[model samples]
Target: MVVNTGLYAFNVTCAHRQITPTVNSIYGDATPPNTPADFEIKVASPSFTRRFFRPQVSFYCDQHSPFKPLPLAQAYALLEWGMNWCIATHDHTRLLVHAAVLVKNNQAIIFPAAPGSGKSTLTAYLAMSGWNLYSDEMAIIDLESGFVSPLYRPVCLKNNSIDLVKQWFPESVFTSTWKDTHKGDVAHLKASSWKQYIQCKPTEIVAVIFPKFVANSDLKIYSLDQLQAFETLSKNAFNYGVLGNLGFKMVDKIIKRAALFEIEFGELCDVQAFLSEDIIR
Candidate 1:
């Protein structure tokens, strides 16, 4: 199947009916049959099906799956992760940063952080609360324009944030929870409207905020210098080393143009207020 992820297209082939529906449910907008696939996935059920104690499924990228088979229930999450891996590894046209992007009125903010940094949780909240989600995992930076493109997919909510997001926005579309993965208890909040994604032009980044969620703490924002921001972003980018000078130029340009900050936030309302009053003008 050829799935067009708005910005990029992927070709996936999976024989399992149990898994296709799940992918379809999350990425139905992209799955239009018979086009060229950017990345091909072929997943197969374990041959040891005779031992029905725990059925498993294996995910293959270009007919090769590096990881071991996972439980049948985790097939969809595996495919999602596989697709993201294929993009990060193969696509080099854009400088990819490990960040969450949110846009409002053609201005965007990039939230770059490490694992367990509450980036995805904040992204899920911003996305559901009147902000357009560019991506939950990647900030695709265009070299020529110095603008970030929207991935326009799901906001992956892991751990407790999954239910927190559900409670905050009951009207949202979410996938079934896949438990015990590398990331604990993962679920994806489908974009509130895929319509917002279709005609997405690259939006200039206004601020690059590194967020760390601290429990029971007040919102704290710290300014980062240009050199500091450059170094920080360079470290967070997946393809920076491979892109060479082009990557450095892009990162430098972004650092020069966008305001840089590191924020430790606890309350969602406080963060939202800060964005509205200070950043999103």
Candidate 2:
């Protein structure tokens, strides 16, 4: 299948038959059949025996398998993650930051955080609540313009957040949860339709937020200086080291242009209020 995911077209072949429905549901008819794709990928059984016994699927990009085989139930998730891996690893035209990107009023803010930091939860909330979700896992910034582009992909919800989001937004579409993955229980939330995603243009990033979720605590915001923001963003980027001098210039441009902050919050509403009342203005 040639799936046009806004940012890139993927030519995906699935040996696991069930993934096709999920792909069609999320992507719709974004691309024509026989269209060219940027990345050629597959989710298939590792061996003939594995296809029948215990049933595991492995992700392949071209001929190379970057990750080990996973349970058959996780084939869709594997395909999504593998697509992200392909872009982050191969595409050097943009600066790929490990962040959740949300845009409002033609201005963008990127939340760069580590695993288990509630980034995806926050992204899922904001995206469903009217913010244009550029990406749940990557902030793809153009090297020259320093503007962020949207990736038509689902927000990955892990562990308890999956149920939390499902309960919070009953209208949202979510994939079946894959139990006991390396990231704990995992599900993907289709926060927006392809129509909405394709309407989003590459927008200038106005802020860099490093968010940490602390249970039952009040929202606390800390302003970060350029030096601090640069250091942290550099660490969060996938191609920072590979881009070298070009990377330095792009990071410098964003740091100089964007306001920087680190936010610790117990409630998603508080974060939303801060961004709307303070940052967006």
Candidate 3:
């Protein structure tokens, strides 16, 4: 099947026996039919029953099954999200931290946290309000330029967050909840528009926020020093060690330009207001 993403075109073919998705670029003269001049993506597999591949830097998902038929929408969403990860890991050589990105006033703010850290919940709320959503899973940074690239993929809401976000933003667009997967009870929010993906731009890193959700604690924002922030950010990186010295320099440059903080909050509205007043404006 062929998917047109405006900026790039992708062709996905499933294998009859494999479990992983492999990509084969069909650039130049080997481009697929109706391929855009800007980018062409061709994926082939010889081992599965279903597959998905995303050519855009923001997202892609490819999977193979023996007996089960995967939903097309779900497969596309997965490929899109996965492709974002693939691009960040392959192109930038910078650390791909698990986090959510929100942009305001042309500056990008990243929330890096472990699972159950309320990152997605916070991101969903911010997206519904006014902030532009970059991603909810991967933080893509350009290694050479020290800029944050946009990954306009869906925000994966897990467990209780599904109900929490539903109650908070009742009009939000959420994919059907999938059960018993990697992250217990997972649902996705397609909050960003396709225009956001095509017009994706790299922005300066303004703030690094490590958020922790405390049900009863008052919203507290702690100032984090460069060393502490760098250490934590490195730990969250997907390819820090892989990129070596270049990665270190890139991370240092980002830290020098951005203020780092650790936030503890329970209310999304309060957090949003605080970030708007303190960080963005």
C-alpha TM-scores of all predictions: 0.94, 0.98, 0.74
Of 1 and 2, which scores higher on lDDT? 2
Indicate which candidate wins on TM-score.
Answer: 2
- Stretches of model 3 off by over 4 angstroms after superposition: 2-10, 14-85, 92-95
Return the candidate ranking by lDDT, descending.
2, 1, 3
Residues 1-281 of candidate 2 have per-residue lDDT tens digits of: 78888778888999877999998878874655355689999999999999999999999999999999999998988898899999999999889999999999999999999999999999999999999999999999999999999988899999999999999999888889989988999999999987798789999999999999999989999999999999999999999999999899999999999999999999999999999999996
Native-to-model Cα distance after best TM-score fit, residue 100 in candidate 1, in Å: 0.4
**Over 4 Å off, model 1:** 31-35, 46-53
Quick one: best lDDT, which candidate?
A: 2
Tens-place lDDT per residue, model 3, 1-281, is 44443323545443222212212111111224464433233233322433444211112233422222334333433454445444444544455766788888888999999988899989988987878877787777877777776654567788899998888778766666767544577777766666555555777789999999999888999999999988988888878888888778877887899989999998888899888999985
**Native-referenced Cα lDDT, model 3:** 0.67
lDDT of 1 by residue, 1-281 (tens): 66667766777777567877777777786536344566777666756671265878777887677778888888888878877888888889999999999988789999999999999989888887888889999999998999999875788889999898899888888999999998889998886566777657789999999999999999999999999999999999999999999999999999999989999999988888899889988
Model 1 residue-pair collision total: 2
Better of 1 and 3 by TM-score: 1
Q: Give the distance in Å from residue 65's predicted Cα in candidate 3 to where it truly belongs.
A: 11
